[model samples]
Target: MFDTMTMTKVVGGLCGTFLVFLLGGWAGDIIYAGGGGHGDHAQAYVIEVASADDAGEVVEEVDFSEIMATASAADGEGLWRNCRSCHSLEPGVNSTGPSLYGIVGRTVGSEDGFNYSGALVAVADVWDADHLNGFLENPKGYAPGTAMGYNGMRKIEDRANLIAYLDSLDD
Candidate 1:
């Protein structure tokens, strides 16, 4: 049979552990609570995030024609590494996205077997140089609601180069 001293020691040990846990929790709340004020105090530091519009102004816009004139298909082949996971450059082979073969002048949403979102079809009829430039620059922006998950090439040169590479695919 267990003695009362052992019972008392067990109870005391549990109570001490509980007390320690409670105090630790209180200390953590005080350290990490970030000043519980009702919108009275200003933030300690203001973070200045450059807006997309401001960034656009800082970077001079490059004309699609200029980029096309200077774009390198060799560099574009390297960039195509990003697209290879989702798209196939081969004709009639669709992967996560439709085959990009001959995409430069092809009709939007016109791949034979790939299922395209309504957004792409509604935006433009043909994927001309200018249209491709805009779409490759920002897929979601050019065609809102498009299922293509690409964030888009930020550099105009990259877009042009990619287009040139794709154009070469069919030739």
Candidate 2:
């Protein structure tokens, strides 16, 4: 025999559960459609522009092309004598250091069939005049923990001349 009280209790519980689910779904839809009450875009800091007079004086740009164009490979070759102890400038030759032949525009640690230091290998991007200049100025600074034992070139002109010499070796 079904009791009326028990049946009413079961129906009331079911109705309460259904109402909770329906309200939950409606609340979720309202929250989703309201766009979270946040701005459409993020705000950014505004950089202030300085006037020409307020900025530091404009320095004239020196043309290094003329200087590099006139630089002699012979001079660079002479300067490279310092590197001869640890490196060779000839192709297919690996000395204490890797070959310097055609190294001006080559990658930082790109000598084939040679064991390069992990420090140098970490930065294998292409080497150009500016990169070589920085490396020659301070090899350790340029590529920290590099194996090259030579101290950096002190003078910028020396680096330029060395670069000119290295450029001549390429086919």
Candidate 3:
């Protein structure tokens, strides 16, 4: 049978212990902590990274034309599966997206029936390889407010292959 007074003493002891531990933690942190903010301490030595601008070296930017020169339409046919859900390869037939039938060489925003974002024609006159490359790399970035909701293909090879596959469709 524990009394109320005994219970109070036990509770007080536990709370006091907890407070001591808490204060110890606070003091220890104050005494042993590292500099609080980022870049507060001097770096010993920066490992020099070879950037394009550094070391009298210039990086030659590889154009997509060079990449597309080696693109494979056969492999690109596989990439077409991802587009089939929203686009059609048949000419004059529109899906959620307009028919990609002659898209590669076709005029921008000129796919007949399907209404485009009106931002595309401002970017380019035709859907040439270079234009298509930039568009496929970033739809919204290239056209600003295109209706296409695609996040865009990041790889140059994929864009080139897909462009090649679309080019092969009209031929």
Give TM per candidate. Answer: 0.65, 0.59, 0.70
Clashing pairs in 2: none
Candidate 3, residues 1-171, lDDT tens digits: the string is: 799999999999999999999999987776668523343678779897886666786557888889999999998999988889999988899989999998888888888899887889899999999999998888999999788898899888998999998898886
1-171, model 2: which lDDT tens digit per residue?
Answer: 579999999999999999999999988877877655754665577778998788778766645565566677788888988888988888969989889898987877778978988886565588878778778889998899998887888866677899999898888
Question: What pairs collide in candidate 1?
Answer: none
The per-candidate count of clashes, in order, stands at 0, 0, 0
lDDT of 3 at 128: 97
Model 1: CA > 4 A from native: 1-59
Evaluated at residue 4, the lDDT of candidate 3 is 100
Best by lDDT, which number? 3
Rank list by lDDT: 3, 1, 2
Off by over 4 Å in 2: 1-67
lDDT of 3: 0.88
Q: Please write out the lDDT profile of model 1 over residues 88-116, one tens digit for every residue.
A: 98899999999999998788889999999
Model 2: which ten-residue window has the lowest total lDDT? 34-43
RMSD score of candidate 2 (Å): 13.0
